[model samples]
Target: MKIQFLNQEHETKFQELRLGMAEYYRNNKEYLSVVYIMAGNEELHRKMNRYFNTKEGMFSSDDMFNEEDFSSGNRILAKLAVHLFNDNETVSPLDIISALDDEWFQLALNAIHFRRYGISSGYDFPEEKLYM
Candidate 1:
């Protein structure tokens, strides 16, 4: 995603949010496969962060997902898919990732990483179509 930040402060907040998510997944290895799509805008990130960082509430409640729940991955992936796709059709990260054979997966990963580091190159796809 393009992930345009209104200002440098928002971009810094997003970086912080990403770091926190990385740590969470690192600590909870079971959820490592849960795919999270970066937001395309700062307002979305702000809203998502509230749920992700809060101690309790609808999104942050303990009942949201348990490690034992096999469907946890689906739930998380669905949430991300909705945000990224914003289509009436439902899609899952696993579905997309599994469809990516080794070559495509590596290409996508490279593109994502390049964007993450704010790097640009001739091979880079447009931000809007990065995932596709």
Candidate 2:
């Protein structure tokens, strides 16, 4: 489950995605706060609540993940990917193998990971894994 940049191009794309995601989060902190709460980040939820002087409301994980405003969905997916895989200097692609429960997140992670690493499964497979 290790993830490594396939080459310079892959590393560059990953860096670009990290920067874009950082910008997205900075510009949409409130929305992302809600997402973090729904993603089970209690510490983030508390920090956001105190920072924003607000409390959690009726938002659900589905609502946050399925947000259709601007590229919120993509941003949310990226945030989750960061949360789940941004540990260690190099991540094991297998780290995300068990996250197939959420099909959308799985798809998004695979897409992002593949776009940045030139591989989807991180494991051996007969056919080429291409994510659309």
Candidate 3:
């Protein structure tokens, strides 16, 4: 995501947060698949960092990228996501959220909910046309 730190300190904090999440899932390793999509936004990253970098929360965006262009899409986390999603095995919501490269926590939440509810792509939530 496009993450712009107000200063170097903020940048450092962001990195710490991202790395912390990565380490958590690496140790757990209990899932069939995971996919992390990075939003690639600087402001969003900073906002997320400020909002999530809390002691009692499940989300954070510290150590976020300076810009979407700076991110290497083929990082260890990305690889893991590919492996997990392709394997078709049940995974952990927290674990999956931790692996996300993107700063968009909402997507992470959606991923967790989707998996928990057993709904794949193209599957409507209620199986009905709401507009009709």
Candidate 4:
């Protein structure tokens, strides 16, 4: 399924916001990912005891990518929607994930417990999809 916007203006505004982000890395081939520290599993969080550039509050679940992310495929997008157009609504970021493709998604999930996370999301991405 695809994102269903409120209307033409809503779609236009969302596209513009995404385009602004996309333009920021037009010539750059490198990619990075958001490392989220979820609200649960404190024991595991402490056992690992390592974090860099992690933002807390909500987590990205494997279930998130499949069909949902609790709130709008992820809360981040919902927040952005609220901030950007005052729309206060969002579809799942799975659309963004789909743009990133499935292999990268699986690779990203696999790396969650790794001590050293890779710079790029995953390999074998096509030119268009390489935007990350």
* Candidate number of the best TM-score: 1
Name the lDDT value of residue 79 in candidate 3.
Answer: 30
Of 1 and 3, the candidate ahead on TM-score is 1
Full-model lDDT, candidate 4: 0.29
Of the candidates numbered 3 and 4, which has the greater lDDT value?
Answer: 3
Q: What's model 3's lDDT at 18? A: 39
| Tens digits of lDDT, candidate 3, 66-101 | 222223322333333333344322345555466544
What local distance difference test score does each model get? 0.36, 0.36, 0.34, 0.29
Q: List the residue pairs that clash in candidate 1.
A: none
Per-residue alpha-carbon lDDT of model 2 for 8-120, expressed as tens digits? 44334433333334343422334332332223323333322232221322223334334423243434444453343332123244544543335444444544544344423
* Colliding residue pairs in candidate 4: none
Candidate 2 contains a number of clashing pairs equal to 7
Clash counts per candidate, in order, are 0, 7, 15, 0
The candidate with the higher TM-score, 2 or 4, is: 2
lDDT of 4 at 6: 30
**Candidates' TM-scores?**
0.27, 0.22, 0.24, 0.21
Q: After superposition, how far is residue 120 of candidate 2 from its true place, in Å?
A: 13
